[model samples]
Target: MEDFVYFFSFQDPNVAMVVAGITLLSISAAMVGTFTFLDKKALLGDAISHAVLPGVCLAFMFAGSKNPYWIVLGAFITGAISTYAIEWISNSTKLKEDTVIAAVLSVFFGIGILLLTQLQQTGDAALSGLDHFLFGNAISIVYEDLMVYGILALLVIICILVFYKEFKLIIFNPSFAESVGLPVKRLKLLFNTLLVMAVVTGIQAIGVVLMAALLITPPAAARFWSNRLHVILMLAVLFAVLSGIAGAFISFAVPHMPTGPWVVMAISFIAFASFFFAGKKGILSKWYNQRNYQQKIHRDHILKSLFQALEKNSKTLEKDEIMEYFPGKEKLTRTYISKLEQENKIELEGEKLKLTPSGLVEAKRVVRLHRLWELYLAQYLNLAPDHVHDMAEKMEHLLTPELEAKLDASLDYPTQDPHHSKIPRDNDL
Candidate 1:
C-alpha cells in the first residue's frame, strides 16, 4: 500500500512521466484493440509485433544508436510488409490464416534475432538498449522515448476518432458497406496499417512478445461487459489504463523489472474479473438468470398442474393428490407450492390447495397459450395433436401476449384445439 502511494505521489517527475506515458499508450492500444478483437484480427497484432523486430535491428544498425524516429520508421516498414505479405499469401494461395501467421512470425523474428546478434557482436554502447525491445524494459524508458510514443499514440487516437463510423460499418458487414459504395478494401488496408503502427510504437516499452496482450486482451475482456461498440471501447480503454498504471508502478517499486509482463498480468486479472462478474453477459449473471428462469418455469408448471386438476375435479386439489401427479418432483412441487403461497398465488384450506381468483386467471392464461399453440402447430405445422402438446407445454411460459395474439389470429380464433379441449377465453375464470 505504501509502495502504491509512493509510486503515484508524483514527487518524482520521472515516475510521473512514465506513468502518464504508459497510460496514454495503453489507452490508445486498447481502443484500437477493441476493434481488432471484434473483427477477430487479434493474431494480426501478434504477427506485426514479431515482424517489427528486424526493423528495429535495422534502424539501430543504420543509426548506430537508439534513435526513436529511425526505429519507428524501420518498425513501421517491416510491420506493413508483414501485414501485406499475410494478406497476399492468404489471397494468392491455399494456405490457412494460422499457417500464414506462423510463417511470417517465425521468418521475421528469426531474421530480427540474426540482425540483433550481429549488432551485439559489434560492442556498441549506444545499441545496448535496442535488445530490450524484444522482451521490453519499461523502467528504462527515457523522456525522449516517451515523447515519441506519445506522438504515435496521439496519431492513433486521431485516426480512430475520424474513422469511427467507417470502421464500425466495415467490421460488422464488409459486404454491406461495399454495397453502400464505401471503400471496403482501402479501409481494410488502412485499419491494418493502424494496427501495425500501434504494435510498432509499443516495441520499446511493452516489447514484441508481450505487446500483443496489450493490443488484444483488454478489449477482449471489455467485450464481456458490453454489447455496444462505444461502451466496449470505453471499458477497454479503462481496463488498459489501469493495467498500464499498475504495471508501471510495480516496475518502479522493483528496480530493473520488465514492465510488459506485469502489465499483461494486470490486464489478465481485469479480464478474469470481467468474465465472471460483469452484468448481463458474465458467467455469474448468466448462471443467476438461468436459475431464476428455471424457477419461474417450475412455478408456471405447478400452477398449470393445479389448474388442470381443478378443471377435472372441480375447484381444488388435496395436497396428496397434487403430490401424486408429480411423484418424481414431489419435493420440487412442495417447494413451489410454498413459494406460491408466499406470493399469495395459492392458498391452503385444511388439507386442500386452491388457487386464488388472481392465480386462476394467470393459470388460465398459461393453459390458453398452451392449447392455442398446440392448435396452431397442428393446423399449420402439420404436427400431430399429441406431438404438439409436448412442444406447446414447454413454450407456454415463453409466449408473449403479442405472440399469443398472432397465434390466435392465425388460427382464426379457434374455440377448441385438435384435442377437443376448450381454449380458455381471455376473461375466463
Candidate 2:
C-alpha cells in the first residue's frame, strides 16, 4: 500500500513523466490495435514490431548517441518497409498472408539481432541503453522522450477520430465500401500508416518484441465486455491505461522486473477474468443459464406426467403412487413434487397429489405440443408412430406458443396423434 502511494506520489518528476507518456502511448496503441484486431491484422502488427529492431540499432549507430528522434525515425522507416514487404510478397505470390508475415518477421528480426550484437561489441558508452528497445524500460522515459512519443500518440488518436467512419467501413467490409464509391484504397493506406506509427511510439515503452501484445491484448480483452465498436474502443483504452500504470508501478517498486512482460501479464489477467465472469457470454453465466434450463425441463416433464395419469384414470394419485412413474428416481421426484407444491402449481390434498388450475393449463399445453409434433412427423414425414415418440419428447419442450399455433393449423387440429393418443385440447384439461 505504501509503495503504491509513493509510486504515484509524483514526488519525482521522472516517474510522473513516465506515467503520462505511457498513458498516451497506451491510448494510441489501443485505438490502432482495436482496428487491427477487427481487420484480423494481428500478424502484420507482430511483423512490424520485430522489424523495428534493426532500425533502432541503425539509429543509435548513425546518431552516435541514444537520440530519441533519430531512433524513432529509423524504427518507423524499417517498420514501414517490413509492413509493405509482407503485403507485396503476399500479393505478388500464391503464398498465404500468414506465411508471408512469418517470413518477413523472422528475416528482419534476425538481421536486427545481428546488428545489435555487432553494436554491443564496439563498447560505445552511448550504446549501453540501446537494448532497452528490446524488453522496454518504461522508467527511462524522460521529458524529451515524452514530448516526441506523446505528440505522435496524439496524432494517431486525432487521425482515428477524424476518419472513424472510413476506417470502420474498410475494416469490416472493404468491398462494400468500395462499391459505395468510398476511397477504400486510400483509407487502408491511412490506417496502415497509423498502425506503423502506433508501433513506433511503443518501441521505447513497450519495446519491439512485446509491442504486438501492447497493441492487441486490450482490444481482445474489451471484446468480452461490449458488442458495440465505440464502446469496445473505449474499454480497450481503459484496460491498456490500467495495465501500463500497473506494470510501471511493479517495475518501479521492485528492483529488476521488466515492464513489458508485466504489462502483458496484467492485461492478460484482465482478459481471462472477463472471459470467466462477463454477464452475457462468460463461463459462469453460461453454466447458470444451462442449470436453469435443466430445472425447467424437469418441471415440464413432471407436469406432463401428472396430466397423462389423470387422462387415464380421471383421478389424482397418492405421492407413492406418483413415484411409480419415475422408476429409481423416487427421491428426486419427491423433491420436484414438493417444489411444484411450493410454487402453487400443484397441491397435496390428503394423500393425493393433484395439479392446480395453472398446472393443468401448462400441462395441457405441453401434452398438446408433444402430440401435435408427433402427428406431424408420422403423418407428413412417414415415420413410424412408435419412432415419433422419442423425438416428440425433446421437441415438446422447445415449441413456443406461436410455433404451437402454427403446428395446430398445419395439422388441421387433429383429434389424435398417429399412435391414437388423445391430443389434449384447450378446454379438456
Candidate 3:
C-alpha cells in the first residue's frame, strides 16, 4: 500500500518520469491505434513493433552505444520499410496483407535477434539491457530516456490531432475522401509514419512484443461502448492511460517483473470485462434483452390463445384447457398466464382464466395485426392463405401500432383475412 501511494506521489523523480512517459506513450498509441483498428489494419501495429527490433540493433552498431536518437531513427526506418513492404506486397501480388505482415515481422525480428546476440557477445555494458526492449523494464526509464521517446510520443499526438478529420475520412471511406480531393495517399503515408513512431515510442517502456496491445486493445475494447469516432478515441485514450499506469506501478513494486506483460495482462482483463459488461453491445446486455424478448413472446402467445378461446365460446377457459393449447409447453404457458394475471391483462378465478377489459383490447389488437398481415401476404405477395398464417404468427408480436394503421389503410380497411375470419378491432371489442 505504501509503495502504491509512493508510486503515485511522484516524490521519486525516476518513478515519476517512467509513469509520465508511459502515460504519454499510451495516449499516442491509443490515438493512432483507433484509426488502425477502424481501417482493419490492426496487424500493421504488430508487424511494425516486431520489425523495429532490427533497427534497434542497427542503431546500436552505428552509434557504438545505445544512443536514443540513432535507435529511434533506426526503429522508425525499419518500421516504415515494413509498413510499405506490406502495402506493396498486398498491392503488387496475390498475397494478402496478413501474409505479408507476418512475413515481414518474422524476417525483421529474426535478423534483430541475430544482430543483438552478436552485440551481446562483445560484452559492452551499454548493450547489456538491449533485451529489455523485447519485454520492458519500466523502472529503468530515466529522464533522458523519457525525453527521447516521450517527445516522439508527443509528436504523434500532435500529428493525430492536426489530421483527425483526414484520418477519419481515409479509414471509413477512402474512395469518397479521394473524390473530395483529400490527398488520401499522402494522408495514408503520414498516418503510417505516425503509427511507426507510436510503436517506436513504446518499445523502450512497453517493449516491442507487447506494444501492439497498447496500440490495438484499447480501441478494440472502446468500440463496444460507442459508435462515434471521437467518443471512441477519448475512451481508448482513457483506457490506455489507466492500463499503462497499472502496469508501471506493478513493475515499480515487484522485483524483476517487466511492465509490458503486466500492461497486456491488465488490458486483457479490461477487454474481457467490457465484452461482458458494456451497455447495448455487451454479452450480459444481449442476454437480458433476449430473455425479455422471449418472455414477451410467451405473453403475447398466451393472450392471443385466450382471445381465440373467447371467440369460440364467449366463456372463461379452464386451467386444463388453457394448458392443453400448448401440450409440450404447459410449464411455460402456466408461467406466462400467471404473469399476465399479475399485469391485469387477465383475471384468474380459481383455475379458470378470463381476459380483463384491457386484456381483451390488447388481445384484439394482436389478432387484428395477425389477420391484417395475413391478408396483405395473401393478396399482394400471392402467398396461399395457409402459407400466410405461419408468417403472420411471427409478425403479430412485432408489428407496432403505427405499422398496424399503415397496414389497415394500405389493405383498404381489410375487413376479412383470406380465410374469411373477421378481423377484430378495438370498436368490435
Candidate 4:
C-alpha cells in the first residue's frame, strides 16, 4: 500500500517523469493507432516496430553512448526506411505487401541483433541496459530520455489534431480527398512519419517487440465500444492510459519485471472484456438479441397459423396439430404456446387453442405485412406471386408500421393481394 501511494503520488521526481512520459506516449500511440487501425495498416505498424531495432544499434554505434536523441533519430530513420521499403517492394514486384513486410521485418531485426551482439562484445559499461530496448524498462526512464520521447509523442499528438480532417478524408476516402486537391501522397508520407515517431516514442518504455501493441491494441479494443471516430479515439486514449499506468505500477512494485509484457497483458484483458460485454456489438448482447428475435419469429408463426385457421372457419386448433407445423421443434413450439397463454394473447380450452383479441390484432398485422410485401414484389419487382411467398415470409417480422404504410400507399391501398385473398388491415377489423 505504501508503495502504491508513493508510486501514484509522484513524490519522486523520477517516478513523476516516468508516469508523464508513459501517459503522453499512450495518448499519441492511441490516436495514431485509431487511424492506422481504420485504414487496416496494422501489419505495417508491426513491421516498422521490428525494423527500428537496427537503427537503435546504429545510433549507439555512432554516438559511442546511450544518447536518447541519437537513439530516437536513428530509430525513426530506419523505421521510415522500412516503411518505404515495404511500399516500394510491394508496388514494384510481384510480391504481395504482407510478404514484403515480413521480409523487411526479418532482415532489419536480424541486422539489429547482429549489431547489438557486436556492441555487447565491446564490454562497455553503457551497454548494460542497451538490450532493455528489446523488451523495455520503464524504470530506467531518466529525465533526458523522458525529454526526447515526450517531445516526439507531443509532436505526434499535435500533428494528428491539426490534420484530423485530412487524415480522416485520406483514410476513409482517398479518392475523394485527392479530388478535393488534398495531397494524398504527401499526407501519407507525413502520416507514416508520425506512425514511426509514435512507435519510437514507445520503444524505450514499451520496447520495440511490444510497441505495436501500444500502437494498435487500444484502438482495436475501443472499436467494439463505438462507431464514432471521435468517441473511439477518446475511448482508445482512456484505455491506453489505464493500461500504461497499470504497467508502470506493476514494474515499480515487482522486482525485475519488464513493463512491456504487463502493459500488453492489461490491454489484452480490456480488449477481451470489451469483446464479450460491449453493449450493441458484444458476443453476449448479440446472442441475446438473436435469441429474442428468433423467439419473436416463432411466436408470430404460431399466431399467424391460428389466424389462418380462423379464416377457414375453425375457431380453434388442437395443440398437437399446431406442433406439427414445426417438425423438429415440437418442444419449442409448445413453449411458445405457453408463453402466448401467459401473455393473454391466446387461451387454451382443453386440448384446443384460440387467439384472444390482442393476439388476433398482432397476428393480423404480421399476415398483412407478409401479403403486402408479396403484392409489392409482384406488382413492382415483377416477381411471380408464387415466387414471392418465401421472401415475404422472411421479411414479415422485420417490417415497421411506417414501412407497411409506405407499401400500402405505393400499392394504392389494394384490398386484395396477388392471390385474390383479403389483405387484412385495422379497418377490416
Q: Show the colliding residue pairs in model 1.
A: none
- Give one digit per residue, the lDDT tens place, for model 1 in 295-363: 888888778878887778668888898888777988888999999999899999988889988888888
Tens-place lDDT per residue, model 2, 90-138, is 9999999999999999999999999999999998887877887898879
lDDT at position 249, candidate 2: 88
Kindly list the per-residue Cα lDDT of model 3 for residues 1-429, writing each as its tens digit: 999999999999898898889999999999999999999999999999999999999999999887889989999999999998899999999988889889999999999899989999998987878888999878888878899999999999999999998899988888999999999889999999999999999998899889999999999999999999999999999999999999999999998889999999989888888899999899998999988988887788778888988888765888898778778988888888888988999998898899999999999998889899999999899998889988998888887788889989999997789999999978884
Cα distance off (Å), candidate 4, residue 155 = 0.7
Provide the clashing-pair count of each candidate structure: 0, 0, 0, 0
TM-score-wise, the better of 3 and 4 is 4
Expressed as tens digits, the lDDT of each residue in 66-134 for candidate 4 is 999999999999999999999999999999888898899999999999999999999999898899899
**Comparison by TM-score, 2 against 3, better one:** 3
Clashing pairs in 4: none
Off by over 4 Å in 3: none
Q: Candidate 4: misplaced stretches above 4 Å?
A: none
Judge candidate 1 at residue 50 and give its lDDT. Answer: 95
- What overall lDDT goes with each candidate model? 0.87, 0.89, 0.91, 0.94
Deviation of model 4 at 221, angstroms: 1.1
lDDT of 4 at 359: 93
TM-score, model 2 to reference: 0.88
